[model samples]
Target: MNLFRLDASILPGNSASAQLADAAEAEWTAAHPQGTVTRRHLGTDPLPADAWALATTASFTPEADRSPEQREALALATALAEELRSADTAILAVPLYNYGVSQHFKTWADLVIAGSDNPTEPLLKSTPTVLATTLGGGYGPGTPREGWDHSTPYLERLLGDIWQAELTVVKRELTLAATNPAMESLRPLAEDHHTQALTAAREAGRALAGI
Candidate 1:
């Protein structure tokens, strides 16, 4: 089996999202000891900001008139799309930043769409995918920040609806409780969220392996 993993945490060393992804990945590895993993860490090695723009422009330009930069961008975009198209399964560890998806991930997604053979077609049709996400504050119904999380819904639409993947999300909120004095009272709930997310991640991983 081939597994594709993507990490988007700016703080890789102390990332809550990565923690859950680790649990899921560990289970997948245990099941498929001989499987190959393709890894990409956007935080450490981000894609070029202009690549998507160049690629999109190239699509409209005739092949013979494409510039060197455009050609390179197109190649990078195609490679990114191929990663999803070729993967048997995938795991994405993305954290909410500023109440929405990070620019790094948005760029990646745009490039993938620009590079696809058919933009309307789902690249990961029926593929099993695990999405591990974390939030620093609580966004549940009674919280002040309720309905403020703009990240998870976008992820679901892009990966599940657009890519047509069978996606399972493992989410942990209130991650800042341990560090922020203002959120000290939420520590207990944060711990609980952490534990539940880990369990869900492992279960998602096991299901991916079985698929």
Candidate 2:
């Protein structure tokens, strides 16, 4: 079994999303002791800026007429595609930024989603995806900005559209400790959510591992 951990947190140790991802990885490791796990920290090692340029160029360029720059660009896209293709399960940790995913996460998504001619093949097919997200304010299934919850919804759509993969979302909202005293007092609540998310991730991993 193979698992890929994509961490998109930008705030170093202070990132709640990254914490959840770590917990998820730990849970998965414990559940499947024999499985192989690979970690990709987009916050630290981001995709090259030329990824977009390569994608765009590849879209129009013929194989024989491609320039060296175009080839490098295609190579990067292919590399990201191969990573996703090789993984049986993927764990994505994304923190909400203004009700949306961080740019780092979006770039990673772009790389994975761009290489496929169908836009969904590389992401949704047989792979299972677990999404862990943290939000500064409360907004979920029925909330006001729920429609605008660019992180969860977009992820669900992308995974479903591309790979037909089953997706499980574990979201923690209203986590701005400074602004919301109630949120600040909900450390236990957040911890509970984290635990639940890890449990869910483990179950997802086990299922994917055929255990």
Candidate 3:
């Protein structure tokens, strides 16, 4: 099985999203000891700033009439699409940035969702995908910041709504509770949430391995 993994957490060692993703990847590796895994660090190697605009323009222009610039743009999008098309299973690790999606993730996801110039072929295929996300604050219903997680809804639209991929979301919330003095009272709960998230991630990883 081929596994494609995307990491979008800017925080390196301290990123909860990355941590959970690592756990998931480990499980996949264990199950498929000889399988190949492709890793893309969106936080560090983001899609070029101009990639989306170029690709969008390319999508509209006829292949014969498209300029070299447009062709170049379309190629990038095709490459991203191929990654998803070729993968048997994929993992997307995204940390909620400022209560919303990361700019890097948005750019890459946009290109991946936007297909190549071919009208007949779909851009992204439905692959089993694991979404590992982290929220610095709690956003569950009845919480102070309820309904504040803008990232989750948009991600659902992209992975579940747009790509039609089988998705399992493993999230760790209240990551800042243990460190932020203001949220000290919630530290115990935060620890529990972290433990649960790790277990879920590992289980999801193992399950994906079987698929």
lDDT of 2 by residue, 1-211 (tens): 7898888888767887776666666666777889898788888888887686677677688888888877887777777777778887878888889778877777777776666665657454667777778887656666565667677777777766556767777677666744567667767665666667666655655555555
Residue pairs that clash (backbone atoms under 3 angstroms), model 3: none
Give stretches of model 3 more than 4 Å off. Answer: 64-67, 116-126
Model 3 whole-model lDDT (C-alpha atoms): 0.86
Better by lDDT, candidate 3 or 2: 3
Q: Rank the candidates by TM-score, best first.
A: 1, 3, 2
- The residue-level lDDT of candidate 2 at 63 comes to 89
- RMSD vs true structure, all candidates: 0.9, 2.8, 2.1
Candidate 1 residue lDDT tens string, 1-211: 8999999999999999999899999999999999999999999999999999999999999999999999999999999999999999999999999999999999999999999987767998999999999999999998999999999999999999999998999999999999999988889988999889989998998998893
Q: What are the lDDT figures for the candidates, one per model?
A: 0.93, 0.73, 0.86
Q: Which stretches of candidate 1 lie over 4 Å from their true place?
A: none
Q: Predicted candidate 2: what Cα RMSD to the true structure?
A: 2.8
TM-score of 3: 0.92
Candidate 3: worst-modelled 10 consecutive residues by lDDT: 115-124
**Predicted structure 1: lDDT:** 0.93
